[model samples]
Target chain A: MIEVAGLKKSFGDVVALRTVSFKAEDARVTGLLGHNGAGKSTSLRILYGLIQPDTGFAKIDGVNVSQDRILAQSKLGVLPDGQGLYQRLTPREHMRYFGRLHGMTEDMIEQRSQELIGMLDMGSIADRRTGGFSQGERMKVCLARALVHNPKHIVLDEPTNGLDVMTTRKVREMIQELKTLGLCVLFSSHLMYEVSKLCDEIIIMAEGRVAAQGTPEQILATAEESSLEDAFVTLSERVAQI
Target chain B: MNILRTIVAKELLDGVRDRRSLFSAFLFPFLAPLFIYGLMTLVIQQNTETESITLPVINADAAPALVAHLKEAGFIIEAFEGDPEAEVAAKTVELVLSIPIDYQKTMAAFETTRVTIIHDGSRNDTSATVRQVRNLVRIYSSELNALRLVSRGVSPKLMRGLQTENGDIASDEQRAANFLSFVPIYVLMAAFVCGLGLAIDQTAGERERRSLEPLLINPVSRLSIVFGKCLAASIVAALGMLITLGMCLGAMLMLPIDELGIRFSLKAQQVVGLIMAILPIPLLASSLQLLLGLFAKSFKDAQSYVGFLVFIPVVPTLVMNFLPFATSFWMYFVPVFGQSIMMKEILGAEPVPLLAYPAAALPTLLAGLLVCWLTSRLLDQERVIQS
Candidate 1:
C-alpha cells in the first residue's frame, strides 16, 4: 500500500501540488488522471523519492519514504514520464545493474533478467545497446527493468506516452494482467480511454488537489455522462477552464 | 559478473558505437600526438639552424692590426666613432664591441682590457647579435692567449690544459634513458587532452542528445553511471598515452634518427622507464579533468573546461626541465610534480633520490582516488541526475 498525505510542494512561487492526498490499495490499478500542469507527474515523482516535498509524506508499505527514502524506494518501481534508460547499456546490462543496486546477486539478476526478457519478448534486443531502440521498445525495456528486481509496488507515469495505438492497447492489456497478479499499480495518464480500459479505480487530479476518486463506471454515472472523458470534464471544470 | 560489470560493458560498447567519439578517443590518440610532437620538432629544427649576423666593432684606438685579425676571423666587423654608447645606438649596426683606446698600454703591462658590449635589449636582433659578439670575443681571446703564450716561450700545446677532453661515457642505455625526461610530460599532456575529449563526449554529449534522462531513470545508483563513464574515459586516455609512447619510440627509431639529426636514441627498455615514470600522472590529470567535465552542462562547456587540463602539464614540464628545482620525496606525490622529477631521473639527471618513489607515487595515486571518489559521490545525488 502507498499513501500520500498533505503533499504540499512549490517551485519558487508556482504551487505544483497543494494538500494532495491519495492511497493506492493492493491488487488494484489506480489511475491518476490529469492534463498538463495538473500535478500528476509531480505527485508520482514525490512518491518515487526523486524529489522531496516541502510539506508531505509518501509512504510505501507503512514506511515514510520522503523521510527515509532508501528504505521506501527499495520496495517500489518507477518508470519516469520523459526520462529514458541509459542508451549505452543493453537491456540485459540494465537489468543486471538495477538488480545489483537492489541487492540481487549476479545469478539472481541473470535469472530475473531472463524471465523478464521472455515475458517482455525482448530477447533479441537484450544484447543490443538501447541507443538505437524504437520508442515503444525503449518503453518496454524500461518496463522490464521496473520488474527486474520484482519490487512489490509499481509507479508508472504515462506508461503509454509517445506509443502507437497498437502498443498502447498491448500496454493496457499488460496493466490488466498486472492487476490480476495482485500487484499494486499506480499509473498516471491523460488519455481517458486508456485509463478507463485498465485502471480499477480512478483518482482525477485538478490543479494541485484531488478532484474525484471512484470506479470509472460509478464516477461516470454520477456525473451523468456515458464516458470517462465526460465525467473527467464534469469534475475538472475549473482546471479545464484555466 | 555483476551489475557493475554490465554497466561497464555497456559503457564500453556504447563508446565503440559512437563513431565520432571512437575517432577522437582511439584514432586521435595516435594521430594527434604524432601531429603535435612532429610539428613541434620540425619547428624547433627550423629555428635552431646556425644563424649569420653582422658584427660591429668599435675600436676607439683605431688599431689596424687587431681589426685585420678580426676581419680574418670572418666577422663582418665595422668601425664606429665616439664613446661606445654613441655607436651602440646607431642604425645598420647589430652591436657595439668596444676595445678600449688604451688596449696596447694595458696589454704591455699584462693587464686585461675591458670590452664593453652594448645594445638595446628589446631590439629584434638583440639575441642573435649578442651571441655573435660573444663568439667574436672568444676568438679574440684565443688569439691573445696564443700570442701571450708564445711571447712567454711556453709550449702552445700547454694552453690546451692537458688536453683533458671529456665526453659523456654513459652507455647507450643511459643516454636513451636520459632522453626519456620528456616522456612523462608528453604522456600526461596527451592523456589529459584525450580524457578531456572523452569525458565531454560522454557526459555533456549524452545530455545534449537527450539520452541522459533514460539513463537517470534506471533503478541503479547514480554512482554506477558516473564511475562507468569515468572508467571508460580513463581507458581511452590510457590508449592515447600508450599510442603516443609507441609512436614516439617508433618515430625515434624507425623514422631515421640520423636523418632527422636528433642524436637522441631511445630503445625499448628506455621506453619502459618512461612508462614507469609517467604511469601516475595520467591518473591524476584524467581524473581531475573528468570531474571538471561532469560539471559541464554542454559539450562546449566540457570542451573548454577540459582544455585547461592540457595546458596544466606545460607548467610542470617546462619548470622541471628549464627552471632550477631540487628533487625531493614530497615532490613526487605532487601529481605532475612527481612524474616530471622521475622523468628527469630517466634522463640521467638523477638528482631525484630513488627513495622518493614511494612518497611520490602513493600520495599522487591516493589523491587521484580521493578526487575520483568525491566525484562519484557528487554524481550519486539525485538532483544531479534530474539536472
Candidate 2:
C-alpha cells in the first residue's frame, strides 16, 4: 500500500505538485492519469522517496518516507521515469545487482532472477549485455530488475510509453499478474485507453492537483459522461476553468 | 558495509568492461617508461658524442704545429675554405677554429697570439665540444710557455703562482637520479590519468545516461554509493601507478645509464619507498575527480574539467622543479608537493624520516575522504538528479 497526502512541491517559482493526495491499496492496479506537465511524475517521485514534498507526506506501508526514507524505499519497487540500465551489464547481472542492493543473499538473488526472467519471457536475452537491446527488450529488463526484490508496493512511471503492441500487451498482463499476487501497483501514464483497461481505480490530475479520482463507474457518474475518456477530458477542462 | 561492498563490486565490473576506461588507465603507464628510456638514451648519446669532436678549421695550413697538437688530442680536422661565421651561423658545423695567418709569426717572436673560436654561445648542444677545444688550446699555450721558461734556465713552476682543483661532493647515483627526477612526476600523473575516464563515467556519465536517479532510488546511503565509486576509480588508478613504477624500474635496469658517466640503480628498499610515497595519491586523485565530475552536466563537460584538473599534480612539480625551496616538515602536509619531495629523496638514495610517510599520506587520505563526503552531499541535492 502506498499513500500520499496533501503533497505540495515547487521548483523555484514554478509549482510541480499542489495539494495532491491519493492512496494506492494492495491487490489493486491504481493508475495515475494526467497530461504532460500535469505533475504525475512528480507525485510518483515523491511516493518513491526520490523527491521530498514541501508540505504533507508519502508513506509506504504506513512508514513515513521523510522520517525513514531507507525503510520506506526498501518496501517499494521503482521503475523510475527513465529506466536507465548499465549497457555493459546483462539482464541477469542487472537483476543480481539490484537484488544485492536490497540485501538479498546470493542464493535468493539467483532464484529471483530466474523467476523474473521466466515470467517476463526474457530467457533468450537474459545473459546478453543490454547495450544493443531493442526498446521493448530494454523495458523488459527494467521491469524484471524492479521486480527482482519482490517489494510489496511497485511504482512504474509510464512503463509502456514507447513499447510496441505485443510488448504493451505483455506489460499489461504482467501488471495484472502482480495485482493478482496481492501487491500494490501504482503506475502513471497519459494514455486513456491503457489506464481504462488496466486500472482498478483511476486518479485524474490537472494543474498539479487531483482533478477527480474513483472507480471507473464512480468516475463516470461524477463526470456525467458515458465513456472514461470523455469523462477525463470534461473533468480536466472543469479543473482548468476553476 | 555490505552495501558499500556491493556498490564497489558493481562499479568495478562496470569499469573493467568499459574499453575507454581501461584504455585511459593502462596507456600512460606503458608510455611513461618508454619515454624515460628514450630520454635517457638521448642524454647518453649526447654525452658520448662529446668525447670525439669533428673540428672545422679555417687556415689549417697556417698552424701545422697547432693542427698536429689537435690531431694528437683526437680532433678530426677538416680544412674548410668557406666563411667560418656563416658556416657556424647556418649550423653547418658546431664550431670553427680560425688560426690567424700571423699565428706562426707571433709564436716565433715569443708573443701571445689569438685563436678565435667562432660559435653560437646560445646553442647548448655544442657547448661541451666547444669547451673541450678551448681547454686543449689552453694546455698547448701553457706547454709552450713552460718550454720557453725552461730554455731561459728558470723553472716552469715559477710561472704557476696558484693551482686550483675541483672537489665535487655529489655521488654518481645522486647525479643519475637527478637526471631522472621527472620519473616521480610521471608516476604522480599516472595516478590522475588512469582513473579519469572511469571517475567521470561513474559520476557525470551516470547522470547523462539518467541512471543516477534509478540507482539512488535504491535503499543505499549516498555516502556508501559515492565511496564505492571512488574506491573503484582509485583501484584503477592504483593499478596504473604500480605499472608505471614497475616500468620505470625496468627502464632504469635496462638503460645504459653508466655510459652517461653516472651510476643509476634502484634498490628493493627504494622501490618500496617509492610505492609508499605514491600509494595515497590515487585516492586523492580519484576523489577529486569524482567531486568535479559530479558538478559537470555531461560526460564531455566532465572530461574537459578533468583535463584541467590534471594540472593539480603538475603545478607543484613545475614549481618545485623551477623554483626550488628549502624542505620543511610542514611541506609534507601538502599532497602532490609532499609526495614529490619524498620521491626525490628516495630516488636520490637519501634517508627519509619515517614520519614523513604518514605525514604525506594522512593528509591526502583525509582530503580524499573530505571530497567524497562533499560528493555524497551533492548527491543528496535534487538538482544533481534533475540536471
Candidate 3:
C-alpha cells in the first residue's frame, strides 16, 4: 500500500503540491485524476523520494519514504513521468540494469526479465535496440523495467498519455493483471473512461490540491452529478472558487 | 559494487557505440601527432635545401682577378651595364659588389682599397648571402697581405701572434630537443580531448535525455553512479592517450630527423616510462571534464565549457613554450605543468630525478578523487536535478 498525508512542496513562490493526501490499498487500482500542473507528477515524485516535500510524509509498505528512502524505494516500482530509456540498450539490458540497482542477483534478474518479457508480450522486441521502437513497444519495455524486481506497490505517471487505442487497451490490461495479482497500483491520468474502467477508487485534484477522493460512484453522488466527467469538472470548479 | 559495475559496463558500451564519441576518443588523438609530423617535415625540408648565392658585380673589367675568385667561391656574378645600387633598390638584384677603377693600382702600390657590398638587410635569407660575400673578400685581402709579408721576408706570424678557435658543446641529441619540445603539450592535450565526448555524454547528456531521474530513482547511492561514470571515462581517456603515444612514436620514427643532424629516436623503454609518468593525467582530465560537464545545463553547454576547460592544461605548456623558465624540482607538484616538464626531460635524454616521478603524479590523482566526490554531491542538489 502507498500512503501520502499532508504532502506540501513549493518552488520559490509557487506551490506545486499543497496539502495533498491520498491512500492506495493493496489488490486495487487507484487513479489520480488531474489536469496538467495539478500536482499528480509532483506527488508521485515525492512518494519515490526523487523530491522532498516541505511538510508531511509518504510511506510505501509501512516504510517512510523520506527517512528510509532506499528501503521504501526498494519495496515500490516507479515509472516516472519521463520514459528514460537508453536508446542503445535493449529491454533485457534495461531490466538487468534496474534489477542490479535494486540489489538483485544475476540469476534473479534473468529469470524476472524472462517472466516480464513473457507477461508483457514483448518477446518480439525483447532483444531489439529501443532506438526506434513504437510507443507501445517502448511502454512495454519501461513497464517491464519497472516490474523487474516485483515490488508490492507500483506507481505510474500518465502511462497512456500518447499511446494509440490498441496500446492504451494493452496498458489497461496490464494494470488489470497487476490488480489481479493483489498488487497495489497507483497511476495518474486525465482520461475519464480509463479511470472509470480501471480504478476502484479515484483521487480528483485541482490546482495542486486534492478536491475529492472516493469510488467513481461516490464521487458522482457527492458532487450530485451523473457521470465521472461532470463530477471532475464540478469538483475542480468548486475548488477553483475557493 | 554491483551498481558500479553495471553503470560502468553500460557507459563503456554506450560510448563505444556512439560514433561521435568514438571519433573524439579514438580518432582525434592520432590526428594531432600526424599533423605535427607533417609540419615538422615541411619546415626541415625548407631549411636544408641548398641554393647558390647571386651578386651583381659593377666594373667587372677593372677587377678580373677578384671576379674570378668570387666565381670560384660559388657566387654567380652578374655583369652590370647600369647603376648597381639602383638595380638593388628596384628589387631586381639582391646584392651588388662594386670595385673601384684603381683596384689593380691600389694592389700594386699596396694601398688601402675599399669595396662596396650593397644588399637588402630586411630579407631573412639575404643575411647568409651577405655574410658569405664579406667572408670571401676578407679571405682574399688576408691572402694578399700574407703574400706581401712573404715577399718582404717578414713572417706573417709576426702580425698575428694569438689564435682563437671555438669548440661548441651541443650534440645532435641536445639540438633535437629544441624541435621536439612541443611533444608533451600535444600528448597532454590529447589526454584531455579524448575523454571530452564521453564525459559530456554521460553527465549532461544523461540529463538532457531525461535518464538521470530514472537512474537515480533506483535504490543506489549517488557516489556509486558518479564513480562508475568517471571510471569509464578515465579508462577511455587512458586508452586513447596510449594509442596517441604509440602514433606519436611512429611519427617520430618515420620522420628523417637525422636530416636535421639530430640523432633522435624513442626506444620502447622510454615510451613505457613516459606512459607511466603520465598515468594519472587521464584520470585528472576525465574527472575535471565530468565536474564541468555536470555543472553545465545541457550537452551543448557542457561541450562549450569543456572547450574552454581544455585551455587549463594547455596554459602551462603555452607559457613554458613561449617564455622558457628555468625548470626546478618543485615544478613536479603542478598537475599539467609537472607532466610537461617531466616528458621533455625524458624525451630529451636528461636523467629524471627519482623523487620527481611521484611529485608529478600524486597531486593529480588526489585532485581527480576530490572532483569525483564533488560531482556525486552535486548530483543530490535540487537545482542540478531540476536543471
Candidate 4:
C-alpha cells in the first residue's frame, strides 16, 4: 500500500503541489489523471523518494520515505517519466543489474528474470541490445526491470504515453495481471479513456490539487454528467474558475 | 561496500563496451612516447651523419706552407676571386679564409701571422665549422714557432709558464636526464586524459541518457554510486598512465642512446618506484573529472571542460622542468606539481627525500576524497538531476 498526505511543493515562486492527498490500496490499480503541469509527476517523484516535498509525507508499506528512503524505496518499484535505457545493455543485463541493486541473490535474480521474460513475452529480444528496440519492446524492458525484484508497490509515470495501440493493450494487460496478483499499482496518465478502462479508482488533479477522487460511476455522479469525459471537463472547468 | 562493488562492476562493463571511451583510455596514451621516440631518432641520425668541411682560401699563394698544411689536414681548399665578406654574406660559401698578401713576410720575420676566418655569426651550423678551421690555424702557427725555437738551439718548454687542462663534471646520467626531460610532463598528461571519456560517460553521459533518475530511485546510497564510478574511471586512468610509462621505458632502452656516450637505462626498481609515486594521481584526476561532469549540464559541456582541465597538470610540469629555482620540500605538497617533481627524481635515479612520497600522495588523496564527497552532495541536490 502507498499513502501520501498533505503534499506541498514549490520551485522558486511557482507552486507545484498543494494540499494533495491520496491512498492506493493493494490489489487495486489507482490512476492519477491530470493534464500537463498539473503536478502529477512531482507528486509521484516525491513518493518515489527521488525528490523531497516541502511539507508532506509519503509512506510505502508503513515506512516513511523521507525518514528512511532506502527502506521505503526497497518496497517500491518506480519507472520514472521518460526513463532512459542503456543502449549497450540487453534486457537481461538490465534486469540483473536492478535485481542486484535490490539485493537479490544470483539464483533468485536468474529465476525471477526468466519468469518476467516469459510473462512479458520478451524471450526473443532478451539477449539483444536495446539500442534500436521498438517503442513497445523498450516499454516492456522498462516495466520488466521495474518489476524484477517483485516489490509490493509499483509506481509508473506516463507508462502508456506515446505507445501504439498494440503496445498500449499489452501494458494494460500487464497492469491487470499485477492487480490480480495483489500488487498496489499507481500510474499517472492524461488519457481519460485509458484511466476509465484500467483504473479501479481515479484521482483527478487540477491546479496542483486533488479535484476529485472516486470510482468511475462515483465521479460521474459527483459531476452530474453522463460520460466520464464530460465529468473530467466539467471538473477541470470548475478548478479553472477558481 | 557490496553496493559499491556492484555499481563498479556495471560501470566497468559499460565502459569496456563503449568504443569511444576505450579508444581514448587505451590508445591515446601511446602517442606521447611514440612522438618523443620519433624525434629522438631523427636527432640521433642528424648528429651521426658526417659532412665534408669546405673552405674558400683567398690569396692562396701568400702562405704556401700554411695552405699546404691545411690541404694535408683534409680541408677542401677552394679558390674564390670575389670579396670574401660579400661572399659569406650572400651565403654562397659557408666560410672564408683570407690570408694577407704579406703573410709569408710576417712569418719569415718570426712574427705572428694574422689569418681571418669569416662566417655568419647567426648561423648555428657554421659555428662548428668555424671552430674546426680556427683550431687548425692555431696548431700550424704553434708548430712553426716550435720549429723556429728548436732551430735557434732553445728549448720550447721554457716558453710555457701555465698549462690549462679542462674537465667536465656532468655525469652521463645527468646528460641523459636532460635529453629525456619531457617524460614527466607526458606521464602526468596521460594520467589526466586517459580517464576523461569514462568519467564524463559515467556521469554526464548517464544524465543525458536519462538513466540517472531511475537508477537513483533504487535503494543505493549516493556515495556508493560516486565511489564506484570514480573507482572505475581511476582504474582506466592508472592503467593508461602505466602503459605510457612502460612505452617510454621501452623506447629509452631500445634506442642507441648508449652509443652517444650517455648512460640511459631504466631499472626495475625505478619502474616500481614510479608506479608507486604515480598511483594516487589517477584518483585525483578521476575525481576532478567527475566533479566537473556533475557540475556540467550536458555531455558536450563536460567534454569541453575536461579537455581544458588536462592543461592543469601540464602547467606545473612546465614550470618545474624549465625554471631554475631550487626545489624545496614544500613543492611536494602541491598536487600535480608534486607528482611531476617526484617523477623527475625517480627518472634521474636520485635518492628521494624522506616524507616526500607521502607528502605528494596525501594532498591528492585528500583532494580526491573531498571532490568525491562534493559529488555525493550534488547527487542529492535537485539542480543536478533537474538540469
After superposing candidate 2, which stretches have Cα over 4 Å from the reference?
Answer: B85-91, B106-114, B120-124, B138-165
- Compose the digit string of candidate 3's lDDT tens values, residues A108-197: 999999999999999999999999999889899989988999999999999999889999999999999999999999999988888999
TM-scores for all candidates: the values are 0.73, 0.93, 0.85, 0.86
Q: Which runs of model 1 end up more than 4 angstroms from their true locations?
A: A66-71, A83-118, A121-132, A217-242, B1-3, B36-182, B208-221, B249-277, B319-323, B349-351, B373-383
Best of the candidates, lDDT: 2
| Residue runs of model 4 more than 4 Å from their true location after superposition | B47-50, B53-170, B259-261
Which lDDT tens digits does candidate 2 get at residues B53-91?
A: 789998999899889999998899999788889889999
DockQ, candidate 2, comes to 0.75
What order do you get sorting by TM-score, best first? 2, 4, 3, 1
> Candidate 3 residues B141-238, lDDT tens each?
88888989999998988868888886757566656766777677777877888888999988888888778888888888777888899889989888
What is candidate 1's lDDT per residue for A1-242, written digit by digit as tens?
A: 99999999897789989779999999999999988888998898788876678897999999897566677878888777764566777898778767776778889989999898988889789999887898778877888878888878988889888888877777787788788888899999998887888888999998888888889877887678887888898888845565
Higher TM-score: candidate 2 or 3?
Answer: 2
- Model 2 clash pairs are none
Q: What is the lDDT of residue B209 in candidate 2?
A: 78
After TM-score superposition, what is the CA distance of residue B240 in candidate 1 from its true location, in Å?
2.7
Per-residue lDDT of B1-387 in model 1, one digit per residue for the tens? 254666656666666766776676566557755775676466444435343334566674455666666566556666676555655566545567777778888878888777778877777536654775577667777778888989899877887866556686765544544444455556667777666665676666766654565455444555566666666677777777788777756654543333333355544665566676666666676668767766776678878887877877667767765776665566766767777667656555334555665667777777777777877665544444454
Model 3, position B11, has a per-residue lDDT of 92
lDDT values, one for every candidate: 0.72, 0.90, 0.86, 0.88
Cα misplacement distance, residue B369 of candidate 3 (Å): 1.8
Q: Write the per-residue lDDT of candidate 4 for residues B192-217, one digit (tens) a residue.
A: 88999989988899989889898899
